[model samples]
Target chain A: MSTLNLTAKAREAATSGDYSELISLVPYAKMIGIECIKLGDELVFRLPAQDGNIGNPTLPAIHGGVIAGFMEHAAQLHLIAAMGGQHLPKIIDFSIDYLRAGLYRDTYAQCQVWRQGRRVANVAINAWQTGQAEPIATARAHFKVD
Target chain B: MSETTIRPRAERFLSVLKHCQNLGMTVEQADSQGLILRLPYSDSIVGDPETGVVHGGAITSLMDTTCGISTVCVLPEFEICPTLDLRIDYMHPAAPGKAIYGFAECYRVTPNVIFTRGVAYQDDRDNPIAHVVGTFMRMGKVTQSEALTKAVNEGRA
Candidate 1:
Protein backbone atom coordinates (compact mmCIF):
# COMPACT_ATOMS: atom_id res chain seq x y z
CA MET A 1 0.00 0.00 0.00
CA SER A 2 1.08 3.54 -0.74
CA THR A 3 2.10 5.77 2.15
CA LEU A 4 -0.67 8.29 1.46
CA ASN A 5 -3.34 5.63 1.33
CA LEU A 6 -2.05 4.06 4.53
CA THR A 7 -2.16 7.40 6.30
CA ALA A 8 -5.65 8.07 5.04
CA LYS A 9 -6.78 4.67 6.24
CA ALA A 10 -5.21 5.30 9.60
CA ARG A 11 -6.94 8.64 9.88
CA GLU A 12 -10.24 7.06 8.96
CA ALA A 13 -9.70 4.34 11.52
CA ALA A 14 -8.97 6.92 14.17
CA THR A 15 -12.14 8.88 13.46
CA SER A 16 -14.34 5.82 13.15
CA GLY A 17 -12.95 4.41 16.43
CA ASP A 18 -11.14 1.47 14.86
CA TYR A 19 -8.17 1.63 17.23
CA SER A 20 -6.73 -1.69 16.15
CA GLU A 21 -6.27 -0.43 12.60
CA LEU A 22 -4.76 2.84 13.77
CA ILE A 23 -2.34 0.99 16.03
CA SER A 24 -1.37 -1.34 13.22
CA LEU A 25 0.17 1.58 11.36
CA VAL A 26 2.61 2.16 14.23
CA PRO A 27 5.53 -0.25 14.01
CA TYR A 28 6.75 0.00 17.58
CA ALA A 29 3.28 -0.51 18.98
CA LYS A 30 2.87 -3.72 17.03
CA MET A 31 6.38 -4.83 17.94
CA ILE A 32 5.57 -4.57 21.63
CA GLY A 33 2.18 -6.29 21.26
CA ILE A 34 0.08 -3.26 22.34
CA GLU A 35 -3.66 -3.86 22.04
CA CYS A 36 -6.16 -1.04 22.09
CA ILE A 37 -9.73 -1.00 23.37
CA LYS A 38 -12.03 1.97 23.04
CA LEU A 39 -14.54 2.89 25.71
CA GLY A 40 -16.58 5.79 24.51
CA ASP A 41 -14.00 8.35 23.40
CA GLU A 42 -11.30 7.11 25.78
CA LEU A 43 -8.79 4.47 24.70
CA VAL A 44 -7.03 1.98 26.96
CA PHE A 45 -3.88 0.07 26.05
CA ARG A 46 -3.16 -3.52 27.00
CA LEU A 47 0.21 -5.23 27.13
CA PRO A 48 -0.19 -8.97 27.51
CA ALA A 49 2.08 -10.82 29.87
CA GLN A 50 4.93 -12.25 27.85
CA ASP A 51 7.94 -14.12 29.08
CA GLY A 52 10.23 -12.06 26.93
CA ASN A 53 9.26 -8.94 28.92
CA ILE A 54 10.45 -10.33 32.21
CA GLY A 55 13.33 -8.36 33.76
CA ASN A 56 13.93 -9.86 37.19
CA PRO A 57 13.70 -13.60 36.80
CA THR A 58 13.84 -14.10 40.54
CA LEU A 59 10.95 -11.74 41.24
CA PRO A 60 9.45 -12.62 37.87
CA ALA A 61 8.48 -8.98 37.34
CA ILE A 62 7.86 -7.26 34.05
CA HIS A 63 10.71 -5.07 32.85
CA GLY A 64 10.50 -1.46 34.02
CA GLY A 65 11.48 -0.26 30.56
CA VAL A 66 8.67 -2.30 29.04
CA ILE A 67 6.19 -0.60 31.32
CA ALA A 68 7.54 2.86 30.51
CA GLY A 69 7.56 2.13 26.79
CA PHE A 70 4.05 0.77 26.90
CA MET A 71 2.80 3.91 28.62
CA GLU A 72 4.62 6.21 26.20
CA HIS A 73 3.16 4.39 23.19
CA ALA A 74 -0.27 4.66 24.75
CA ALA A 75 0.09 8.43 24.99
CA GLN A 76 1.18 8.72 21.35
CA LEU A 77 -1.72 6.59 20.15
CA HIS A 78 -4.10 8.59 22.30
CA LEU A 79 -2.97 11.77 20.56
CA ILE A 80 -3.39 10.17 17.13
CA ALA A 81 -6.87 8.98 18.00
CA ALA A 82 -7.85 12.37 19.40
CA MET A 83 -6.31 14.56 16.71
CA GLY A 84 -7.18 12.34 13.74
CA GLY A 85 -4.00 13.43 11.99
CA GLN A 86 -1.50 11.55 9.86
CA HIS A 87 1.57 13.21 11.28
CA LEU A 88 3.43 11.21 13.90
CA PRO A 89 3.99 13.13 17.13
CA LYS A 90 7.59 13.77 18.13
CA ILE A 91 8.34 13.17 21.79
CA ILE A 92 9.95 16.10 23.57
CA ASP A 93 10.40 14.48 26.97
CA PHE A 94 8.97 11.85 29.26
CA SER A 95 8.85 11.50 33.05
CA ILE A 96 7.78 8.24 34.63
CA ASP A 97 7.27 7.21 38.25
CA TYR A 98 7.31 3.55 39.09
CA LEU A 99 4.92 3.10 42.02
CA ARG A 100 5.16 -0.64 42.27
CA ALA A 101 6.86 -3.61 40.74
CA GLY A 102 4.88 -4.64 37.69
CA LEU A 103 4.09 -8.27 38.21
CA TYR A 104 4.15 -10.94 35.53
CA ARG A 105 0.64 -10.30 34.35
CA ASP A 106 -1.28 -8.34 31.78
CA THR A 107 -0.86 -4.56 32.21
CA TYR A 108 -3.24 -1.80 31.13
CA ALA A 109 -2.62 1.92 30.53
CA GLN A 110 -4.80 4.97 29.97
CA CYS A 111 -3.85 8.46 28.78
CA GLN A 112 -5.23 11.92 29.49
CA VAL A 113 -4.35 14.83 27.27
CA TRP A 114 -3.98 17.75 29.62
CA ARG A 115 -3.41 20.32 26.92
CA GLN A 116 -3.19 20.33 23.15
CA GLY A 117 -1.82 23.58 21.82
CA ARG A 118 -0.91 24.46 18.27
CA ARG A 119 2.65 23.26 18.51
CA VAL A 120 2.75 21.16 21.67
CA ALA A 121 0.63 18.77 23.67
CA ASN A 122 0.98 17.37 27.17
CA VAL A 123 -0.27 13.96 28.24
CA ALA A 124 -0.53 12.15 31.53
CA ILE A 125 -0.65 8.35 31.53
CA ASN A 126 -1.21 5.68 34.14
CA ALA A 127 -0.70 1.93 34.04
CA TRP A 128 -2.07 -0.76 36.32
CA GLN A 129 -2.53 -4.45 36.51
CA THR A 130 -5.71 -5.15 38.52
CA GLY A 131 -7.22 -1.82 39.48
CA GLN A 132 -6.96 1.75 38.40
CA ALA A 133 -6.88 2.89 41.98
CA GLU A 134 -3.49 1.28 42.40
CA PRO A 135 -1.37 2.24 39.48
CA ILE A 136 1.92 0.43 38.91
CA ALA A 137 3.39 3.43 37.13
CA THR A 138 2.45 6.95 36.08
CA ALA A 139 4.00 9.05 33.34
CA ARG A 140 3.74 12.53 31.86
CA ALA A 141 4.92 13.29 28.35
CA HIS A 142 5.33 16.33 26.14
CA PHE A 143 5.04 16.05 22.37
CA LYS A 144 5.73 18.43 19.56
CA VAL A 145 2.35 18.14 17.83
CA ASP A 146 3.09 20.31 14.83
CA MET B 1 36.10 -0.39 45.88
CA SER B 2 37.45 -3.56 44.31
CA GLU B 3 36.94 -3.37 40.54
CA THR B 4 37.59 -7.07 40.30
CA THR B 5 34.72 -7.93 42.64
CA ILE B 6 32.14 -5.42 41.36
CA ARG B 7 32.91 -5.86 37.67
CA PRO B 8 32.28 -9.61 37.68
CA ARG B 9 29.13 -9.21 39.74
CA ALA B 10 27.79 -6.56 37.40
CA GLU B 11 28.46 -8.81 34.41
CA ARG B 12 26.67 -11.71 36.10
CA PHE B 13 23.66 -9.56 36.94
CA LEU B 14 23.33 -8.25 33.39
CA SER B 15 23.63 -11.74 31.91
CA VAL B 16 20.87 -13.01 34.19
CA LEU B 17 18.43 -10.17 33.44
CA LYS B 18 16.28 -11.21 30.48
CA HIS B 19 15.32 -7.70 29.36
CA CYS B 20 18.97 -6.56 29.25
CA GLN B 21 19.78 -9.64 27.21
CA ASN B 22 16.86 -8.93 24.89
CA LEU B 23 18.19 -5.44 24.21
CA GLY B 24 21.66 -6.88 23.47
CA MET B 25 23.23 -4.48 26.02
CA THR B 26 26.77 -5.33 27.07
CA VAL B 27 28.82 -3.70 29.75
CA GLU B 28 31.66 -1.70 28.23
CA GLN B 29 33.14 -0.44 31.50
CA ALA B 30 32.36 -0.59 35.23
CA ASP B 31 34.32 1.24 37.86
CA SER B 32 34.00 3.49 40.90
CA GLN B 33 33.11 6.42 38.69
CA GLY B 34 30.22 4.76 36.77
CA LEU B 35 29.24 2.18 34.18
CA ILE B 36 29.05 2.32 30.38
CA LEU B 37 26.85 0.02 28.24
CA ARG B 38 26.56 -0.42 24.50
CA LEU B 39 23.41 -1.11 22.46
CA PRO B 40 24.20 -2.30 18.94
CA TYR B 41 22.07 -1.30 15.97
CA SER B 42 19.19 -3.61 15.16
CA ASP B 43 16.36 -3.22 12.66
CA SER B 44 13.99 -4.95 15.05
CA ILE B 45 14.25 -1.98 17.43
CA VAL B 46 13.58 0.76 14.92
CA GLY B 47 10.70 3.05 15.89
CA ASP B 48 10.33 4.91 12.62
CA PRO B 49 11.02 2.53 9.79
CA GLU B 50 10.97 5.34 7.25
CA THR B 51 13.94 7.04 8.88
CA GLY B 52 15.25 3.85 10.49
CA VAL B 53 15.82 5.76 13.72
CA VAL B 54 16.01 3.78 16.93
CA HIS B 55 12.95 4.04 19.15
CA GLY B 56 12.95 6.42 22.10
CA GLY B 57 11.76 3.52 24.18
CA ALA B 58 14.87 1.52 23.31
CA ILE B 59 17.05 4.40 24.45
CA THR B 60 15.02 4.75 27.64
CA SER B 61 15.45 1.05 28.34
CA LEU B 62 19.17 1.30 27.75
CA MET B 63 19.49 4.26 30.10
CA ASP B 64 17.45 2.62 32.83
CA THR B 65 19.42 -0.60 32.55
CA THR B 66 22.68 1.29 32.54
CA CYS B 67 21.73 3.25 35.65
CA GLY B 68 20.65 0.12 37.49
CA ILE B 69 23.88 -1.63 36.59
CA SER B 70 25.84 1.36 37.75
CA THR B 71 24.01 1.25 41.05
CA VAL B 72 24.95 -2.41 41.42
CA CYS B 73 28.57 -1.59 40.76
CA VAL B 74 28.56 0.85 43.67
CA LEU B 75 26.75 -1.42 46.12
CA PRO B 76 28.57 -3.78 48.38
CA GLU B 77 26.18 -6.65 47.68
CA PHE B 78 23.52 -7.64 45.19
CA GLU B 79 20.13 -6.01 45.74
CA ILE B 80 16.95 -5.32 43.83
CA CYS B 81 16.86 -1.58 43.28
CA PRO B 82 13.76 -0.72 41.29
CA THR B 83 13.43 2.61 39.54
CA LEU B 84 11.37 4.96 41.66
CA ASP B 85 11.26 7.69 39.07
CA LEU B 86 13.03 8.56 35.82
CA ARG B 87 13.01 11.71 33.71
CA ILE B 88 14.51 11.74 30.21
CA ASP B 89 15.11 14.65 27.86
CA TYR B 90 15.67 13.89 24.20
CA MET B 91 18.48 16.13 23.10
CA HIS B 92 18.46 14.79 19.56
CA PRO B 93 17.35 11.83 17.49
CA ALA B 94 20.05 9.21 17.41
CA ALA B 95 21.83 8.87 14.09
CA PRO B 96 20.55 5.79 12.33
CA GLY B 97 22.71 2.67 11.78
CA LYS B 98 25.18 3.28 14.59
CA ALA B 99 25.60 1.52 17.89
CA ILE B 100 24.40 3.71 20.79
CA TYR B 101 26.26 3.89 24.08
CA GLY B 102 24.75 4.79 27.46
CA PHE B 103 26.94 6.14 30.27
CA ALA B 104 25.41 6.05 33.76
CA GLU B 105 26.72 7.06 37.17
CA CYS B 106 25.22 6.52 40.56
CA TYR B 107 26.27 9.78 42.12
CA ARG B 108 24.55 9.23 45.44
CA VAL B 109 23.65 6.08 47.37
CA THR B 110 21.77 6.61 50.62
CA PRO B 111 20.23 3.99 52.84
CA ASN B 112 16.94 4.01 50.94
CA VAL B 113 17.54 5.57 47.56
CA ILE B 114 20.14 5.74 44.81
CA PHE B 115 20.42 8.74 42.47
CA THR B 116 21.65 8.28 38.91
CA ARG B 117 22.41 10.36 35.87
CA GLY B 118 22.89 8.90 32.40
CA VAL B 119 23.55 10.06 28.86
CA ALA B 120 23.01 8.15 25.61
CA TYR B 121 25.19 8.92 22.64
CA GLN B 122 26.29 7.40 19.38
CA ASP B 123 29.62 8.90 18.20
CA ASP B 124 30.65 11.58 20.65
CA ARG B 125 30.00 11.77 24.38
CA ASP B 126 29.42 15.52 24.09
CA ASN B 127 26.63 15.08 21.53
CA PRO B 128 24.20 12.94 23.45
CA ILE B 129 20.95 11.61 22.06
CA ALA B 130 19.22 11.78 25.44
CA HIS B 131 19.87 12.63 29.07
CA VAL B 132 18.30 10.84 32.02
CA VAL B 133 18.18 11.46 35.77
CA GLY B 134 16.55 8.91 37.96
CA THR B 135 16.11 7.77 41.53
CA PHE B 136 15.89 4.12 42.49
CA MET B 137 14.56 2.75 45.76
CA ARG B 138 16.92 0.29 47.34
CA MET B 139 14.73 -2.71 48.08
CA GLY B 140 17.35 -4.69 49.91
CA LYS B 141 18.86 -7.98 48.78
CA VAL B 142 17.16 -10.13 46.19
CA THR B 143 16.00 -13.55 47.32
CA GLN B 144 18.73 -15.69 45.87
CA SER B 145 16.83 -18.42 44.12
CA GLU B 146 18.97 -21.38 43.18
CA ALA B 147 18.32 -20.81 39.50
CA LEU B 148 19.25 -17.14 39.66
CA THR B 149 22.28 -17.77 41.80
CA LYS B 150 23.43 -20.59 39.54
CA ALA B 151 23.11 -18.34 36.50
CA VAL B 152 25.19 -15.63 38.18
CA ASN B 153 27.84 -18.17 39.18
CA GLU B 154 27.95 -19.61 35.69
CA GLY B 155 28.30 -16.13 34.25
CA ARG B 156 31.21 -15.49 36.58
CA ALA B 157 32.81 -18.82 35.60
Candidate 2:
Protein backbone atom coordinates (compact mmCIF):
# COMPACT_ATOMS: atom_id res chain seq x y z
CA MET A 1 0.00 0.00 0.00
CA SER A 2 1.28 3.50 -0.80
CA THR A 3 0.03 4.85 2.52
CA LEU A 4 1.86 2.18 4.49
CA ASN A 5 4.93 0.42 3.16
CA LEU A 6 4.23 -3.10 4.29
CA THR A 7 7.13 -5.47 4.19
CA ALA A 8 6.80 -9.08 3.09
CA LYS A 9 6.69 -10.13 6.71
CA ALA A 10 4.00 -7.62 7.47
CA ARG A 11 1.97 -8.74 4.52
CA GLU A 12 2.36 -12.36 5.55
CA ALA A 13 1.31 -11.48 9.10
CA ALA A 14 -1.67 -9.64 7.77
CA THR A 15 -2.89 -12.69 5.91
CA SER A 16 -2.05 -15.08 8.69
CA GLY A 17 -3.94 -12.93 11.19
CA ASP A 18 -0.81 -12.36 13.21
CA TYR A 19 -0.91 -8.63 13.99
CA SER A 20 2.24 -8.20 16.02
CA GLU A 21 4.34 -7.17 13.04
CA LEU A 22 1.55 -4.99 11.73
CA ILE A 23 1.21 -3.24 15.07
CA SER A 24 4.95 -2.56 15.16
CA LEU A 25 4.84 -0.89 11.74
CA VAL A 26 2.99 2.07 13.23
CA PRO A 27 5.10 3.95 15.77
CA TYR A 28 2.19 5.26 17.80
CA ALA A 29 0.69 1.81 18.17
CA LYS A 30 3.96 0.55 19.50
CA MET A 31 4.31 3.55 21.78
CA ILE A 32 0.92 2.82 23.29
CA GLY A 33 1.59 -0.93 23.48
CA ILE A 34 -1.35 -2.31 21.48
CA GLU A 35 -1.70 -6.06 21.17
CA CYS A 36 -4.10 -8.21 19.19
CA ILE A 37 -5.41 -11.72 19.55
CA LYS A 38 -7.54 -13.73 17.19
CA LEU A 39 -10.45 -15.48 18.79
CA GLY A 40 -11.97 -17.91 16.35
CA ASP A 41 -12.46 -15.45 13.40
CA GLU A 42 -12.73 -12.30 15.49
CA LEU A 43 -9.88 -10.01 16.52
CA VAL A 44 -9.80 -8.38 19.91
CA PHE A 45 -7.45 -5.44 20.45
CA ARG A 46 -5.73 -4.97 23.79
CA LEU A 47 -3.99 -2.06 25.42
CA PRO A 48 -1.86 -3.01 28.42
CA ALA A 49 -2.00 -0.53 31.23
CA GLN A 50 0.91 1.91 31.42
CA ASP A 51 1.56 5.00 33.49
CA GLY A 52 1.92 7.20 30.43
CA ASN A 53 -1.67 6.50 29.37
CA ILE A 54 -3.27 7.94 32.47
CA GLY A 55 -5.24 11.21 32.14
CA ASN A 56 -6.57 12.07 35.58
CA PRO A 57 -4.36 10.80 38.36
CA THR A 58 -7.00 11.75 40.89
CA LEU A 59 -9.54 9.30 39.49
CA PRO A 60 -6.75 7.20 38.03
CA ALA A 61 -8.74 7.13 34.81
CA ILE A 62 -7.28 6.43 31.41
CA HIS A 63 -7.00 9.52 29.29
CA GLY A 64 -10.07 9.97 27.11
CA GLY A 65 -7.66 10.70 24.28
CA VAL A 66 -5.78 7.47 24.80
CA ILE A 67 -9.02 5.51 24.70
CA ALA A 68 -9.92 7.29 21.48
CA GLY A 69 -6.49 6.64 20.02
CA PHE A 70 -6.59 3.00 20.94
CA MET A 71 -10.08 2.54 19.51
CA GLU A 72 -9.13 4.31 16.29
CA HIS A 73 -6.05 2.17 15.75
CA ALA A 74 -7.95 -0.97 16.54
CA ALA A 75 -10.49 -0.07 13.90
CA GLN A 76 -7.75 0.68 11.39
CA LEU A 77 -5.96 -2.58 12.00
CA HIS A 78 -9.19 -4.53 11.85
CA LEU A 79 -10.01 -2.87 8.56
CA ILE A 80 -6.59 -3.75 7.20
CA ALA A 81 -6.97 -7.36 8.22
CA ALA A 82 -10.48 -7.56 6.85
CA MET A 83 -9.45 -6.18 3.46
CA GLY A 84 -6.80 -8.88 3.18
CA GLY A 85 -3.96 -6.38 3.27
CA GLN A 86 -5.10 -4.82 0.04
CA HIS A 87 -4.51 -1.24 1.10
CA LEU A 88 -4.06 0.95 4.14
CA PRO A 89 -7.06 3.09 4.99
CA LYS A 90 -6.72 6.74 5.90
CA ILE A 91 -9.07 7.97 8.61
CA ILE A 92 -11.37 10.70 7.32
CA ASP A 93 -13.32 11.26 10.51
CA PHE A 94 -14.20 9.65 13.84
CA SER A 95 -17.09 10.14 16.27
CA ILE A 96 -16.74 8.61 19.70
CA ASP A 97 -19.12 8.46 22.67
CA TYR A 98 -17.55 8.03 26.02
CA LEU A 99 -19.85 5.70 27.90
CA ARG A 100 -17.83 5.62 31.09
CA ALA A 101 -14.50 6.83 32.36
CA GLY A 102 -11.82 4.50 31.09
CA LEU A 103 -10.23 3.09 34.21
CA TYR A 104 -6.48 2.66 34.56
CA ARG A 105 -6.29 -0.99 33.56
CA ASP A 106 -5.86 -3.21 30.57
CA THR A 107 -8.44 -2.20 27.99
CA TYR A 108 -9.93 -4.15 25.08
CA ALA A 109 -11.64 -3.20 21.85
CA GLN A 110 -13.49 -4.92 19.02
CA CYS A 111 -14.25 -3.42 15.61
CA GLN A 112 -16.94 -4.24 13.12
CA VAL A 113 -16.88 -2.97 9.55
CA TRP A 114 -20.36 -1.62 9.02
CA ARG A 115 -19.91 -1.18 5.29
CA GLN A 116 -17.15 -1.13 2.72
CA GLY A 117 -17.39 0.43 -0.69
CA ARG A 118 -14.91 1.14 -3.45
CA ARG A 119 -13.60 4.37 -1.93
CA VAL A 120 -14.56 4.29 1.72
CA ALA A 121 -15.24 2.05 4.70
CA ASN A 122 -17.20 2.65 7.88
CA VAL A 123 -16.22 0.93 11.12
CA ALA A 124 -17.88 0.70 14.51
CA ILE A 125 -15.60 0.25 17.50
CA ASN A 126 -16.35 -0.66 21.10
CA ALA A 127 -13.87 -0.48 23.98
CA TRP A 128 -14.20 -2.06 27.39
CA GLN A 129 -12.07 -2.56 30.45
CA THR A 130 -13.74 -4.86 32.97
CA GLY A 131 -16.29 -6.60 30.77
CA GLN A 132 -17.67 -6.71 27.29
CA ALA A 133 -21.20 -5.76 28.36
CA GLU A 134 -20.00 -2.48 29.82
CA PRO A 135 -18.18 -0.56 27.16
CA ILE A 136 -16.07 2.38 28.21
CA ALA A 137 -16.40 4.01 24.81
CA THR A 138 -18.08 3.44 21.48
CA ALA A 139 -16.98 5.03 18.20
CA ARG A 140 -17.80 5.16 14.51
CA ALA A 141 -14.99 5.90 12.09
CA HIS A 142 -14.98 6.61 8.36
CA PHE A 143 -11.84 5.77 6.45
CA LYS A 144 -10.69 6.49 2.92
CA VAL A 145 -9.73 3.04 1.65
CA ASP A 146 -8.56 4.12 -1.76
CA MET B 1 -10.13 35.97 32.25
CA SER B 2 -6.89 37.92 32.44
CA GLU B 3 -3.78 36.36 30.95
CA THR B 4 -2.06 36.37 34.33
CA THR B 5 -4.76 34.22 35.94
CA ILE B 6 -5.42 32.01 32.94
CA ARG B 7 -1.76 31.27 32.26
CA PRO B 8 -0.87 29.58 35.54
CA ARG B 9 -4.26 27.99 35.87
CA ALA B 10 -3.91 26.47 32.45
CA GLU B 11 -0.42 25.31 33.24
CA ARG B 12 -1.50 23.90 36.57
CA PHE B 13 -4.54 22.25 35.05
CA LEU B 14 -2.53 20.68 32.26
CA SER B 15 0.20 19.52 34.59
CA VAL B 16 -2.25 17.16 36.31
CA LEU B 17 -2.94 15.25 33.09
CA LYS B 18 -0.18 12.70 32.69
CA HIS B 19 -0.93 11.89 29.07
CA CYS B 20 -0.78 15.57 28.15
CA GLN B 21 2.73 15.72 29.53
CA ASN B 22 3.62 12.52 27.72
CA LEU B 23 2.51 13.98 24.42
CA GLY B 24 4.58 17.12 25.07
CA MET B 25 1.60 19.45 24.91
CA THR B 26 1.72 22.95 26.36
CA VAL B 27 -0.75 25.73 26.90
CA GLU B 28 0.07 28.39 24.36
CA GLN B 29 -2.74 30.81 25.17
CA ALA B 30 -5.97 31.01 27.16
CA ASP B 31 -8.45 33.85 26.79
CA SER B 32 -12.03 34.69 25.97
CA GLN B 33 -11.80 33.06 22.58
CA GLY B 34 -10.69 29.75 24.06
CA LEU B 35 -7.66 27.66 24.83
CA ILE B 36 -4.79 27.23 22.37
CA LEU B 37 -2.72 24.14 23.06
CA ARG B 38 0.26 22.92 21.09
CA LEU B 39 1.31 19.33 20.33
CA PRO B 40 4.91 19.14 19.19
CA TYR B 41 5.91 16.76 16.42
CA SER B 42 7.77 13.68 17.53
CA ASP B 43 8.86 10.46 15.90
CA SER B 44 7.26 8.39 18.57
CA ILE B 45 3.86 9.54 17.40
CA VAL B 46 4.43 9.05 13.68
CA GLY B 47 1.71 6.94 12.03
CA ASP B 48 3.12 6.41 8.58
CA PRO B 49 6.79 5.54 8.41
CA GLU B 50 7.11 6.27 4.71
CA THR B 51 5.64 9.76 4.98
CA GLY B 52 6.58 10.51 8.61
CA VAL B 53 3.12 11.94 9.24
CA VAL B 54 2.10 11.91 12.85
CA HIS B 55 -0.71 9.51 13.68
CA GLY B 56 -4.30 10.66 13.54
CA GLY B 57 -4.62 9.35 17.07
CA ALA B 58 -2.13 11.91 18.32
CA ILE B 59 -4.13 14.65 16.72
CA THR B 60 -7.26 13.19 18.28
CA SER B 61 -5.57 13.25 21.65
CA LEU B 62 -4.63 16.89 21.23
CA MET B 63 -8.11 17.89 20.18
CA ASP B 64 -9.76 15.86 22.93
CA THR B 65 -7.50 17.41 25.53
CA THR B 66 -7.99 20.86 24.13
CA CYS B 67 -11.76 20.58 24.02
CA GLY B 68 -11.99 18.99 27.44
CA ILE B 69 -10.11 21.78 29.10
CA SER B 70 -11.70 24.58 27.13
CA THR B 71 -14.75 24.38 29.39
CA VAL B 72 -12.86 26.25 32.07
CA CYS B 73 -12.86 29.40 29.99
CA VAL B 74 -16.66 29.56 29.85
CA LEU B 75 -17.66 28.33 33.26
CA PRO B 76 -18.08 30.57 36.27
CA GLU B 77 -15.87 28.30 38.35
CA PHE B 78 -13.59 25.34 37.81
CA GLU B 79 -15.49 22.03 37.59
CA ILE B 80 -14.52 18.48 36.80
CA CYS B 81 -15.84 17.88 33.34
CA PRO B 82 -15.54 14.59 31.47
CA THR B 83 -15.87 14.21 27.76
CA LEU B 84 -19.32 12.88 26.88
CA ASP B 85 -18.60 12.56 23.20
CA LEU B 86 -16.33 13.96 20.48
CA ARG B 87 -16.34 14.13 16.70
CA ILE B 88 -13.18 14.83 14.74
CA ASP B 89 -12.57 15.30 11.03
CA TYR B 90 -9.07 14.93 9.70
CA MET B 91 -8.76 17.27 6.76
CA HIS B 92 -5.31 16.00 5.91
CA PRO B 93 -2.06 14.75 7.31
CA ALA B 94 -0.10 17.34 9.23
CA ALA B 95 3.25 18.42 7.86
CA PRO B 96 6.01 16.50 9.55
CA GLY B 97 8.50 18.23 11.85
CA LYS B 98 6.02 20.95 12.72
CA ALA B 99 3.94 21.42 15.83
CA ILE B 100 0.13 21.26 15.67
CA TYR B 101 -2.04 23.71 17.58
CA GLY B 102 -5.60 23.10 18.81
CA PHE B 103 -7.90 26.06 19.41
CA ALA B 104 -11.09 25.12 21.20
CA GLU B 105 -13.93 27.25 22.57
CA CYS B 106 -16.78 26.16 24.80
CA TYR B 107 -19.69 27.78 23.03
CA ARG B 108 -22.47 26.67 25.37
CA VAL B 109 -22.52 25.70 29.01
CA THR B 110 -25.78 24.22 30.21
CA PRO B 111 -26.52 23.02 33.71
CA ASN B 112 -25.15 19.54 33.01
CA VAL B 113 -23.36 19.66 29.67
CA ILE B 114 -20.85 21.86 27.86
CA PHE B 115 -20.33 22.10 24.09
CA THR B 116 -17.02 22.88 22.43
CA ARG B 117 -15.61 23.18 18.95
CA GLY B 118 -12.08 23.69 17.67
CA VAL B 119 -9.59 23.19 14.88
CA ALA B 120 -6.07 21.82 14.72
CA TYR B 121 -3.80 23.98 12.60
CA GLN B 122 -0.15 24.46 12.00
CA ASP B 123 1.33 27.84 11.06
CA ASP B 124 -1.79 29.10 9.33
CA ARG B 125 -5.00 29.08 11.23
CA ASP B 126 -7.00 29.14 8.04
CA ASN B 127 -5.58 25.85 6.84
CA PRO B 128 -6.50 23.47 9.58
CA ILE B 129 -5.31 19.89 9.58
CA ALA B 130 -8.39 18.76 11.53
CA HIS B 131 -11.60 20.02 13.10
CA VAL B 132 -13.40 18.81 16.20
CA VAL B 133 -16.64 19.31 18.11
CA GLY B 134 -17.02 17.80 21.53
CA THR B 135 -19.37 17.67 24.51
CA PHE B 136 -18.51 17.17 28.14
CA MET B 137 -20.53 16.36 31.28
CA ARG B 138 -20.13 18.64 34.23
CA MET B 139 -19.16 16.55 37.27
CA GLY B 140 -19.27 19.32 39.84
CA LYS B 141 -16.35 21.25 41.28
CA VAL B 142 -13.05 19.50 41.21
CA THR B 143 -11.54 18.29 44.46
CA GLN B 144 -8.08 19.66 44.09
CA SER B 145 -5.33 17.36 45.25
CA GLU B 146 -3.19 18.45 48.14
CA ALA B 147 -0.16 18.64 45.93
CA LEU B 148 -2.01 20.65 43.28
CA THR B 149 -3.38 23.09 45.84
CA LYS B 150 0.09 23.52 47.31
CA ALA B 151 1.55 23.96 43.87
CA VAL B 152 -1.01 26.57 42.94
CA ASN B 153 -0.44 28.50 46.14
CA GLU B 154 3.30 28.35 45.67
CA GLY B 155 2.94 29.41 42.05
CA ARG B 156 0.82 32.35 43.10
CA ALA B 157 3.28 33.36 45.80
Q: Could you list the chain B TM-scores for each candidate? A: 0.90, 0.89
Docking class of 1: medium
Residue-wise C-alpha lDDT for candidate 2, range B1-157, written one tens digit per residue = 5545666666777888888899999999987679999999999999888788999889999999999878768765556788999999988889999999999999988899999999999988888999999999987655644444444335431
User: Candidate 2 — which residues are off by over 4 angstroms?
Assistant: A1-4, A7-10, B1-3, B142-157
Q: Which 10-residue window of candidate 1 chain A scores lowest in summed lDDT?
A: A1-10
Q: Write the per-residue lDDT of candidate 1 for residues A38-89, one digit (tens) a residue.
A: 8877788899998877887877888888888889888988888778856577
What DockQ, between 0 and 1, does each candidate earn? 0.55, 0.65
Worst 10 residues of 2 chain B by lDDT: B148-157
Worst 10 residues of 1 chain B by lDDT: B141-150
Q: Worst ten-residue run, lDDT, model 2 chain A?
A: A1-10
* DockQ-based class of model 2: medium
